[model samples]
Target chain A: MQHFLRKTVAVFESLGDRSLDSFERLGRSTLFLVRVFKSIPFVFLRPWLLIQQLYSVGVLTIVIVLVAGTFVGMVLGLQGYNILVRFNSESSLGTMVGLTLVRELGPVVTALLFAGRAGSALTAELGLMKTTEQFSALEMMAVDPFKRVIAPRFLAGFLSMPMLAAIFSAVGIYGGYYVGVYLLGVDDGAYWAQMQKSVDFHEDFMNGVWKTVVFGFVATWIALFEGYDSVPTSEGIGRATTQSVVNASLAVLGLNFILTALMLETS
Target chain B: MTRQILEIWVGVFVAAGIAALFMLAMKVSNLSTVSTGDTYEITARFDNIGGLSIRSPVKASGVLVGRVSNIKYDKDYSVAVVTMSIQNRFDSFSIDSRASIYTAGLLGEQYIELVPGIEDNYLEDGSDVVMADSALILENLIGRFISEIISK
Candidate 1:
């Protein structure tokens, strides 16, 4: 028993040492990222990063947004209508659609879709670059890898998230309208009119937009951090990609709670 | 490259369509009469304007015709003063147009509802709607009812 205890202690100490080393490396890369952000004015020197981010966030993810938004809206409308039908208060569909889409579904669904698609891709690309020593090569040439690779992606993810959230909100509301009005046979005028009346500028739309910004930062930062720290091996690259998706998704959810709490407190 | 270009065009179209739909829906709803030269202003005072927001609809007989334009606190009256823009078609609103803050449903939004009265004097733009009602918040009403029942 004593021998087992000793072995366990030794294992724990080695694990702790490894974790400390990883954190130290993370600290350095984060500082490097900060420096790259400071030099964003020089982004005119490399427009490809912006284009790449735009393409990745906007153009590539349209189908996912469309499908997800439509399905989610349909489900919400169906479920909400089921519950509301008990009271014979079907006209509250507008408030229901507006509230659900703006407060919860808009930001959360978009972030999840982004994580599955662009977030994974970003991690793998960065991980491969790290594993191939391409990052080191760029450094050797006095080219800042953070500026060339990390910053552009970070900016792209950040900018793309809000735009995606907007699209998600718009599409989701329309989806709800279609399902509620046409399919479910609810009054079209009341469904839309109620939404217009119920949805306030400050409470609904602004809160949704605010949450997306946080989601963007969390997704980009976690994905980039994971990729930047990948070990120089195929296995390491694979591990980093997996970690990126998991970490980015978790971070998106975690930050969403924090933002919701903060918004509630302030409001 | 061709695929990318096509994809970009599709995205733009999708985005534009969504935006246009929202605008069209808002236009068709006609909640506010700001566009049709049918807007008239009226003021209401409330003791508390809980969750009352600018641009919230003003409804009469469940038909929307205007919106809350501004809100302010009256120091002398110790009340919240809400200014609303009603349609000029509702121009024959009497001096007794009663404004009440009511919820759409349980756990839903709040809007100012106007119950038009049959008094002689007509309410003009910038005139005060004499009778005003505040929201009977659910918690407060329930609490009062429960207390009364318990006491009884």
Candidate 2:
């Protein structure tokens, strides 16, 4: 009876501890976010750091975005053609491909890819720095590590996302055109005409840009936060890197849906 | 040397992004409309607009001439009022020119198709296009098909 009572107390205590731990994590994350935002001015002041970060994060990620984008567009062309053929409206293929890529798939897919590619790298790099006491070394040298280390990468990731998304969407449209027009033989004129008639610059394109910007900020924030707070060990670095990718990807997708709904509903 | 190379590549990347955006705006979203010289406004009333909304392209002979600027309900006339902006270059449309709402495909966006008339006199700004055909609603057609089958 005494043993049973002790087990019950232990379970309750663990639950309390879990809640407290999560609350503490939330508080820490908020503080980290503020610190990161405060470090933004340093990104402008130290342009070379931003450029280096951009090269590592942005330039390196371009090929993947392009390859992924092209394939996605081709698939959209094939599927949209098949469905539209049933309705005897295959000529609207361009509208389907353009709207899908520009409004929804482009930003969302690029962000997920960005999260997987850059977010994980940032987390791992920072975690490794932590493990090797590099951040501490900077502190000892009277350097603000947040401005020196974190700000440039954050700015690069934030800036790179929208540009990558734009490229993806553009390449995707071409892929769609090749498949829909050349492979499937949909009327080329009607395809473009339909798209031009339907798509609006202010409504679809700008909304997509807004979404990617927000996603970029969120993704970079999660990556940097996870890195900054990771335990100073090899296993901890690996875990934080995985967590950063997973968390950023999920946040991006959730925000995409909310933003899409708000954008579509409003205008 | 490495810095210069990297800067060049970065500049190329930024240029490509901007170029892609320009294509999106100009070719895809019709941003060239702003450069389309001055336009004259005209109004048309329709019995039913169906899915026609503001900014729907106004086409002449399958060529884009202008766009629908606004849509409002004409309560007194029991119809929908559609305001259109026809470009100055294409201002030769006669007063008797017919305006019809047309759908490109079986399932596609609706647009305004203007058919030029024989009248040599041209339509002026703020003039009402009296002859107009409303859009054919799909649901109504489907209903008619069902009712015809029932009667048969």
How many clashes would you count in candidate 1?
Answer: 1
Q: What are the Cα lDDT values of the candidates?
A: 0.78, 0.89
Among all candidates shown, the one with the greatest TM-score: 2
TM-score of 1: 0.73
* Candidate 1 C-alpha lDDT tens digits along B1-152: 66567556545844653563354335323324335566888899998777888878788898877889899999998999999998888777788989999887676568999987989889998999878888878888899999999999
Superposed Cα deviation of residue A240, candidate 2 (Å)? 1.2
lDDT of 2 by residue, A1-267 (tens): 999999999999999999999899989999987887898897788898888888888888889999999999999999999999998889889999988988999899999999999899999999999999999999999998989999888898998898889988989988989999999999889878777756777887878789889988999889988999999999999999999999999999999889989987876
In candidate 1 chain A, what residue range of length 10 has the lowest lDDT sum?
A196-205
How do the residues A118-158 of candidate 1 rate in per-residue lDDT, one tens digit apiece? 88888888888888888989999998777777777888788
The alpha-carbon RMSD over the true interface for every model, in angstroms, is 4.9, 1.2
User: What alpha-carbon RMSD in Å does predicted model 2 have with respect to the real structure?
Assistant: 3.7
Per-residue error at B98 for model 2, in Å? 5.0
Q: Per-prediction DockQ, in order?
A: 0.14, 0.51
Native A-B interface contacts kept, per candidate: 0.02, 0.46
After superposition, candidate 1 runs with Cα above 4 Å error: A1-26, B2-152
